[model samples]
Target: MSIDSTRFILLNTSHYGNIGATARAMKTMGFSDLVLVAPRFADALVHEDTVAMASGAADILVRARVVGSLAEALDGISYACATAMTPRDFGPATHAPRPLFAELARSEHRVAFVFGSERFGMANDDVYRCHACISIPTHPDYGSLNLAQAVQLLAYDWRQALGGFEVAPRVPDASLADGAQVQGLLGHWQQALTDIGFLDPAAPKKLMPRLNQLLNRAELSAEEVHILRGIARAIQRRG
Candidate 1:
């Protein structure tokens, strides 16, 4: 299933923060089609708490659709999965998110994950309408989940099944010190240690070897080697 074709649907959501948090969750997972089925407040799409919780995903709230009913929200969607605790006597077969999502990944279905209100979960009718009811495994004593948290967990699992995004580091990786550079730095530090009276040449023992092991473990970068050499120069000047 294409991430672009997936939608997150919320029914009768009572808090603006939930709407905002949902937008943030969807954006992080590379899914953004959001639909609200008769939310408690008309301004929920742009409420202060919603915007605040959304962080930087306001574009999702702007494109989100508000509909009168679940039918309207699922107009172009081919599949719907209810994120409600399965009804004891009735409703569709309950499935765990990861396995169901893996199965869905092969199909071309335009899927939707439907969530219910915070106070009361989806009604029996809502669970019955969905193709599958997803009961996120939680502690037996408490399975209650925050509306945004459920959406996030479901979205994350689905995204992983569809193939996750590549992680990138914020800063460019520094060039590591070559063997020669590390040796040079070690020699400089050894001199500085002796000059500072921290290491005695007659009683050197394994001090330099132990320090060399520490630097090797640190994986010092070329720039770090230069900095250490500079400190060694300062110590020599002081002596």
Candidate 2:
């Protein structure tokens, strides 16, 4: 029930303001360690709309990490659930929130609840990554939740899991990669991409910038970054 150990990841957010709002939502609930997967606005959020939405939760927004794929985003999670408006093969739809939190309370595992973009929920392959799905009930006619609102709902459940306990001192997530290691992996990724001819060497103008946007947004921990770099190296070795 310690909130620090749990991860609430947002996948493919398009708006900087929503990202900021999500950050604010988490912070308001005494939760931090929010992760964004393939966020559309990497640069624009730094200006102001995001900060304004964060309000007092600006620090959480500042500390957010962005990553590329859902697989990579959920790299270290032991228990994963994808939130959806419709249910899939693994589980039925959740019209209520308490039972889900009740399940979360019983397990001492490291869990991550993944939310997809507003435009499209989650892909079938992405849903395959999770053990189940969480659905927030609303008026059956119009139950869709805004991105930030969805995050707020999950954050509230996480708070309940803690039994209203005071926010514990921030402990580093053992799963995330350190900054230096992530930097090295980024370098390796660029080099590998160029080696594979995915990037043009001479005309590599926007390539690094794009890579920076992708990698920097992840803010990957040392461990996660190395795991990813290892995959990249393996691919190169295999090729």
Best by lDDT: 1
**Cα lDDT of model 2 by residue, 140-208, tens digit:** 799877889998988887677667657676976576665677668878887788778887878888877
Evaluated at residue 84, the lDDT of candidate 1 is 82
* Ten-residue stretch with the least lDDT total in model 1: 84-93
The per-prediction tally of clashing pairs is: 0, 8
Off by over 4 Å in 1: 196-214, 230-239
The pairs that clash in candidate 1 are none
The lDDT per prediction is 0.91, 0.77
- Compared with the true structure, what per-residue lDDT tens digits does model 1 show for residues 49-95? 99999999999999999999888888888889999874647768899
| Candidate with best TM-score | 1
